[model samples]
Target: MSGTVALITGASSGIGEAAALSLASRGASVALVARRADRLAELADRIRGEGGVALVVEADVTSQEAAVAAVRRTVDELGRLDTLVNNAGVMLLGPVVDAPVEEWQRMVSVNVLGLLYTAHAALPHLLAAATNGRRKVADMVNVSSVAGRVARNGSGVYNATKHAVGAFSESLRQEVTGRYVRISLVEPGAVSTELADHNRPEILETIRQRFADVERLEADDVADTIAYIVTRPRHVAVNELLVRPTQQQA
Candidate 1:
């Protein structure tokens, strides 16, 4: 992880934020991308204060232009790209019967479209870096969810978005593995993250209650897994990792 350049989406908080810190601690130059400029700046400052490199990029990953620019900015300032962690996602949990249409749209846009935007822009650079001796190995890690694997009733739209990510990551892995570029997907189950705050209050309360009995995994749990994925040797490509709390059933 040391001396790697990592671009983390949703780096302002939660898993994204934890990934930033974990990578930085191991000597990765982190590019923090999110809509929250203030939070990004704060995190960057914290990383710098601890003698690590960090860049704060304010943008909505859902925008193609913004996604491309974020990658450009990272390469421009940091010199090269080593890893891209697509960790930005949203969860709008509710029954399919009367689920909010807007929530479904938002989920699709942020989770699916945003991942594509970031991945598309970084492909050329990752491919180029992978062939070089100096930067022989580069990684692309997409953060999906347990919902991506299992279709839970209330998490239908969320599941759809995550499933798309899994499919895309696998297909991309096949395309780039021949080029020596690594592509991986991290499917997390019931980790404590800000995703819950995005849900409706009543729904949030009900969902929270289910996990109340067990000690849920922290955002850093997923972060640690991402750090491990990108830090592996150039020849090693971890296709997918599903990190779940011991108590989680679905």
Candidate 2:
């Protein structure tokens, strides 16, 4: 991990923040990218205080231009890009019947379009780094969800977005694996993060009660999975990982 640069999106909090700390601790210089500038600055400070290199990139990945700029800035300033964690996403779950169309748009924008934009911008650099960097391989970890596998009544759009992520990751992985750039997917279930807060006020309690009996996973748990995928030996590509709390049956 030393001498490598990793860029993570949705890095202001939750899994993104945890992944940034985890990778930095392991010697990868981290670039924290999210719309929140203040939070990124704070995380950067914490990483630096721990003697780890950190870069704060404040941009909304929903915009293709911002995504491109973020990737370019990371390579220009950090020297090279070896890993990309596409963690920026939003979940606004509700029944498809008369649902807020805006919520569906938001999910598609962040979960699918944003991921595509960032990966497109980072691919060239990742390919270049894989050819000449210290590790001889590059990694792209796309954060997905269990919703990708199971389609519940109330989460149709969310399921669609995550399924798209899963599909895209597999195709991309096949296209790049021979070139030394590994594309992996990490799907998590019922994590205790701000993801649920994005739902409407009336839908919040239902989400909580549905998972009441289950002990949710912490952000660090998923972060550890991301770290494991990228830290594997060059020959070992952990293509996809699905993590769930012990009590989460589905």
Clashing pairs in 2: none
For every model in order, what is the number of clashing pairs? 0, 0
Model 2, position 129: C-alpha lDDT score: 91
Model 2 CA deviation exceeding 4 Å by range: none
Q: Write the per-residue lDDT of candidate 2 for residues 87-187, one digit (tens) a residue.
A: 99999988999999999999999999999999999999999999999889999999999998899999999999999999999999989999999999999
Q: 62 in model 1: Cα distance from truth in Å?
A: 0.7
Query: 1-250 in candidate 1: lDDT tens per residue?
Result: 6666889999999999999999999998999999999999999999999999999999998999999999999999988788899999999999999778999999999999999999999998888778763758889999998888999778888989999999999999888899888999999988887889978899999888989987899999999899899878777889999989998877
Each candidate structure's TM-score, on Cα atoms with residue i matched to residue i, is 0.97, 0.99
Q: Candidate 1: misplaced stretches above 4 Å?
A: 133-135
